[model samples]
Target: MFGELTNGRYVTLARSDLSRLLFERIKDTTEIIFGNEIVGLEEKSDGVRVRLKHGGERKFDLVVGADGLHSGVRRLAFGPQHQFEKKLGYAVAAFEVEGYRPRDEDVYLMYGRPGRMVGRFTLHRNRTLFLFVFVVDSDPLPTALKMQQEMLREKYEDGGWECPRILEELGRTDELYFDSVSQIRMNGWSKGRVALTGDAAFCVSLLAGQGSALAMISAYVLAGELLKADGRHQEAFLKYEASLRDYIQTKQQGAARFATALAPRTQLGLLFRNLVTNAFVIPGLARLVIGKEITDAVQLPDYHWQSSVI
Candidate 1:
């Protein structure tokens, strides 16, 4: 909402590498399950019985749904997907390609057209990441990755800037994360022994640039509450929801509005947006408005841990 180029401290990387790094860090402690999905959940007095699509059934004291917007756990526990999803009338896709580095590795370059925006960031030497966001009128989203790629090519093939070049690299990339830009909002994120977190429970979407961090924070609070309650999940779930609801609600609404404004519907609107953003939105102002304040939003509790080893 300003007229200037903004600067902020951000670490850019290829999404695939980021995923790999996180998995490696957690592999030792968390059993890594692949090619299986939760299809059914039965809540019992002491624990939840979970049925898997491929693996055999198992039981756990708690099931925290940290899946993305199309969460299977959320569907099984809450309801069908339609009841809680609010589409922001847009779609986004990202991939890696060769040789499109920006002059300053720290600076992210973005190009915008009416109803569409494309961003390029340097990942490392001789590698770059391309991000595409555009207005879409589809519901339930396209299921196939190939179909999503085709849609992007059709939507941006004729556009100026690096769009055409990026489209050329579509079929060559190894994988793509493509989805409709939507948020998940629910009246209640917990039921009995099961609770939801991250994009599964309350996704503010990428416009806010705070999903992953907020998700980690939610998990921290949830774990802390469980410890405080001595594993009484009912009370822990209550405290977890109460602590996170207002903060997440405010974030989700603000992000939806910001996403809408990010992509203008007409060429004139796009021009006006660019002019105002470049003319007045200074780096200092940008940091003040959207940067430092994000990390400072929540005040975490100091939990006193009792000795576990007797």
Candidate 2:
């Protein structure tokens, strides 16, 4: 699937490593205030007033919510998350373990049953990442890590193919990423001097397999539009939404189909999915089947950014 889709143009790195790489590039120029949260935002005639959790207030020309799906900025600016969130009837969890045995280098191994699927991929430094996707019946999922782990164990304890061993390693790890597969939909990405970007604005969900890429694209477009607008944030926010709203909506629609494809709810659906995956071996069929999904159709504008502005 990757061979035909990516055409050898993709690299997989741990999310932490990617964050570190980006931070290194901007640390000198950017002021990063860790251990603080945005508790409130008040828009003014000229700028937005940001109230931090630590009892500090700062003003900025424009405030952007680049935060993820459960974005605090989005809530403060747009309203409650429930208003814009659309749950995709699925849940996903991922964790990595070091020195896990039975590693398949550069190969993504997957096993699926009705309503559930597990995938394993090797990473650098003898680390193995495991991803679990399954159908969910309700929302307000457990927030506690121990409860999340117990839920996964209940769902996969009787399963096959490394389930037991993976659960064993799960006990030893403290970091686990778990969340519902949901997308953010909004009529607008901005409210006054406050604007949103990345998953905070429009998340295509985890099944889309392009959240990171879309997030980067959104940030790039937002930055470029802001630069072109010359500090007029209202104009920049409108342009940013115009540039990516339709494209992001298309991706979100495609991602809705992926939830069922990843973890089919019935035996017939699972059989059909397997048949389609097996058919990928046929020459040019994979591309013909999923060409539109793999290809990015949006033409990014080349904003001639000045070095000083950057």
Candidate 3:
């Protein structure tokens, strides 16, 4: 089964079709089980035996943990996220700020030197998303919401440049996503028959704006590798890790560097950032730098997907 794109708008339907589509093309019949969480796993001569939370057991040839950020599977298979996650001393909080119109064509970027930046991006339609990220040196996440509101009032209260309008909207929205600008690093993506994909394996983090793309690419490659191994699951897992390892590492490095550039700590860093953005406003220069920067970050290989199960 396939999903049809919604008329006159883009819709996210992949989550709905994932499980059903995977089972559709499989040829040989296999037992399908659900609602059981694997609590323990052991290596056996034949394969791996997994213990379930519901007092159940199953021997599987392979296990894939594609679960996101705080992944339970990763904790079981690899170590813990905290061991690999690097905190950048920055707090990011974002919520929808309504009635803030920056442009009819594209989003607005507001930048300042003091480790603060606000970007208003137009979403699907009629609504804008406000993203504010700052560097506060200490544990800034606790009072992040309240601080953001104060910062908003102070920075934008008297501004004639779309800032006042944006502040008005920011005051109304209470919900937000708050976190440290961080990346996940894993030396290996495979352990025995257990494999990982997406954020669980390696998180590109928020600053690079490549997390979503990296996750999609990782999923596609992992699935293809599994199919290519021809039921030799260990080989498939290793191959998948080998292929994507370098790519993921490179992306993580890039994200770390980018986080620094976005919220530079030094006075020279602030001056440099402002000078660059302000000077590069010329259409030609702006296009050259911004285009090349983003493209370099997101550049990845094409993994063609085909159904071998049938």
Candidate 4:
């Protein structure tokens, strides 16, 4: 349950829309590459050599893995994901359907049972986004999209309250996002000439409800540190980790506790969660319950940017 926010209002934007908006801002200034993946990274004393999936290689003074949770850069730079990934015993899936019935604008509708929940929210253009969160036993979920769909169907086969319709709609859509709700913990986020940011470094998990915000915060801080160091990556990476390590650890701890709250594993847990959620209607009760959780306590450093390039 989310409490009242006195400082800022909430705005929901589809990930595709958000990606387009960010790309539009940097398209002109940044060299955009598409359809290529990083396969190998070799760090040298002077620079890092990045090997592409398509047999291309490039060298840069430094490399930053802004990639998502399953980051290849992280694997090459640090180690395998298992060494750092901490699964929170849950999986999440989401997809969108156009012209779906019972569209509720500006509101999120959710239904829950023991160990699982489904939510739906309306988007622009007569589209509705459905999100599924459920308990999972292990990592390495099905990779194929079809398998993922079947898995969702199996998980929600006995579900009620529009779940049947949601699954029926799910069959018609091609794109579905599915992954384990896990966090990445590491002793450090950088090594040699390479550094990590966003979900690659410290994913507080989706249940934390701040993955995107924290990603942006890490990126901003990493860039600011780079600027302050005048492109001296060693100094910048150290400062970047120091500035946000404690803040991120706190967020991860909170997220680990939020898994059950997101989808209660038992009926009693669900009932208690419902009672607490309903109590939020009382004035200032939501704040009193989750005031600290909702607030962004990090004191972001103020960095001045000039026309000169780093």
On lDDT, the candidate that comes out on top is 2
RMSD of 2: 1.3
As a TM-score, model 1 comes out at 0.87
Clashing pairs in 3: none
**Per-residue lDDT of model 4, residues 63-124, tens digit only:** 99989899999998898999999999999999888899888888888799999999999889
| Candidate 3: tens digits of C-alpha lDDT, residues 55-163 | 6788877777767676778888777778877787776767774455555445356554456666666655466777766776665346567776776566446555566
Question: Which prediction has more favorable lDDT, 1 or 2?
Answer: 2
- lDDT scores for all predictions? 0.79, 0.88, 0.67, 0.88
lDDT of 2: 0.88
Highest-scoring model, TM-score? 2
Query: For model 1, how does the per-residue alpha-carbon lDDT over 205-278 read when each residue is reduced to its tens digit?
Result: 87677777788789888888988899788899999889989888878877886786678778998887777557
Clashes of each: 10, 0, 0, 0
Worst 10 residues of 4 by lDDT: 1-10
Candidate 1 regions off by >4 Å?
Answer: 1-30, 101-104, 279-284, 287-295, 305-310
Distance from true position, residue 82, model 1, in Å?
Answer: 0.7
Q: Count residue pairs with overlapping backbones in model 2.
A: 0
Candidate no. 2 TM-score: 0.96
Residue 303, candidate 4: alpha-carbon lDDT: 89
Q: Which segments of model 3 are wrong by more than 4 Å?
A: 1-60, 102-104, 143-168, 278-293, 296-310
Candidate 4, which segments miss by more than 4 Å at Cα?
1-3, 308-310
